[model samples]
Target: MARLNLWRWGVFGLAGLYFLVPLAASVVFTVDVPGQGLTVDAYTQIVGTGGFGSSLLLSLELALATIAVVLLLMVPAMVALRLGAPKLRPVVEVVCSLPLVVPPIAFVAGIVTVLKWGPEHLSRTPLFQTFVAIQNPDFPVVLVLAYVVMALPFVYRALDAGLRAIDVPTLVEAARSCGASWPQALVQAVLPNLRGALLNASFLTLALVLGEFTVAQLLGFRPFAVWIVNVSGSQAQLSVAVSVMSLLVTWLLLLVLAGFGGRSRTTSRG
Candidate 1:
């Protein structure tokens, strides 16, 4: 027992060092200057920076939109498949997982080609306005679409695991027997049982959108991640501070999500 305890402590210490070391270095680098021992100037400067507010708000909006779109698209489809056609789940799963195999650059390239071709082909028609509206800089529908595709794999897996854990057919039947419509059955019966899965999916999608850079940058939208990169060129310390702040935000979000999810699981199990 003594040896086992010692081994556990040793493993934990190593794991802590692995994560904490880099965070410590980042803290030092952000605040430490040649002559200044310690200063909050780097952190303080973040607020004054232009584009910080707009970029962060834009990313937050995109994240919310992505979560909404993913949930609306996935939840009903998953429930329908589970209850109506189990065999089709595999086919749907493969489609959702395609995002994992496709490189972001390639995916974005296809999107660019489609967007470019749309106007050229659909020019002089009302359809061109539809294409133009999607690429609007203030609220880029293109980014939301790309984010939904990128997030599909994670969202599907989360929801799939939750569905597997619950007996969907039984629950839906019970709800229907009680005079509920299919939509109401899903809302009142199925979704309550999927609280944890919903939180997990939303958290992953939010984090992915928050940290995603490649797609947004390549497509010419200056989101939170792209803004960080752009600021890095001009204000190195402030950029590092922003990175640390973003990391803290991610951690805070995860903790809150886990808290709610864990409580839901515990209550349900009880």
Candidate 2:
């Protein structure tokens, strides 16, 4: 037992070093300006940086939109597949997983093509406004649509796993027998059980949107990730500093998510 414990700690320490070393190096790079020795200008300047706040805000908005839309579209479809048509679950799963097979570069290319085609081919029709509206730089609906597709597989898997763990049909049936309508049963009994799954799906979608640069950059929109790259050319140290902070934030969120999921599992077991 002592030997096993030592081995466990050794592997953990190694893994920690592997992650921490690069981050430490990045921190040093950001603060240790050649002759300045150590300064925090890089970190401090982040707030004043021209596009930093707007880009971060835009990314957060996109993340929120992506999470809400994906969950709304996926949760009911998955529940129905669970309670009504079990065999169709596989088909839906395949459809969701299709995004993983498509490369990001190709995906952006297709989006670009569609955007170009809409202006040229559909310019005369009123529906052309539909295309124009979606591409609005202030809040691009097009990005949300793309993110929903990208997030489908993760959302499906999380929800599916959650459903499999509990007896969905029994819960819904009990709710129905107790005089609850479909919407009420779903809102009350079903979603409560799916709390952890919903959180997981939301976090995954949030991460995808915040980290995604290809689609946003290709579409000429400057969200958080692209802003990081854009500033790198001029403010290298500040860029690194921002990168470190964002990574720390992401890790913090993951830890919080893990704790939430762990509690849900514990409660379910109890």
Candidate 3:
């Protein structure tokens, strides 16, 4: 028993050192500048910087949009496949998981080609307006679309697990027998049982959108991650400070998700 306990603690201790070492180095580099006493100067400058507010806001908006779109698209599709067409579930799963196998650079490259070709070939068509609108630098419809694709696998898995745990067919049948429509059945009867899954999917998608750099950067949109890299060029310490803060924000999100999830599980158990 003592040997097993020591092995477990030793493994955990090594993992903690692996994760904390770089974070400690970053904190030191961010605050302990040569000849400058420990100060909040770099952290303070994060707000005053030119693109700080806008980029962060843009990323936040993108995260929200991605969450909404993923939920709307995946939840219903997953439920229907599970309840109505079990055989199609594997096919749907493969499609959702494709984004995982496809490299982000290649995915963004395909989008770039489509964007370029749309203007040249489809300029006279109504779809050209969509192309123009999606590229909007302010709120980036393109980024949201890209993020939705990137987040599909995570959202699908979360919802699928939730669906597996519950009696989906029975729930829908009961809701229907109670004179509820399909939408109501899903919105009220089904989704309540899926609160944890919903929160988990939202948190994962939000974190993915916040941390994603290659797609947003290559797509010519400046989001939170891109801004950090841009700021690093002239203000190294400030960039590290912002990166540390971003890490904290992501961790905070995870904690919030866990809290809500725990409450949800307790309620379900009761």
Q: Pick by lDDT: which candidate is best?
A: 1
The lDDT of each candidate is 0.93, 0.90, 0.92
Clashes of 2: 0
> Model 1: which ten-residue window has the lowest total lDDT?
260-269
In angstroms, give how far residue 109 of model 2 lies from its true place.
0.7
What C-alpha lDDT, on a 0 to 100 scale, does residue 50 get in candidate 3? 94
Ranking by TM-score: 1, 3, 2
Q: Which portions of model 2 miss their true places by more than 4 Å?
A: 252-270
For 49-68, candidate 2 gives per-residue lDDT tens digits of 99888988888899889988
In the range 71-119, model 1's lDDT, one tens digit per residue, is 9999999999998999999899999999999999999999999989999
Per-residue lDDT of 165 in model 3: 91
Worst ten-residue run, lDDT, model 2? 248-257
Ordered by lDDT, highest first, the candidates read: 1, 3, 2
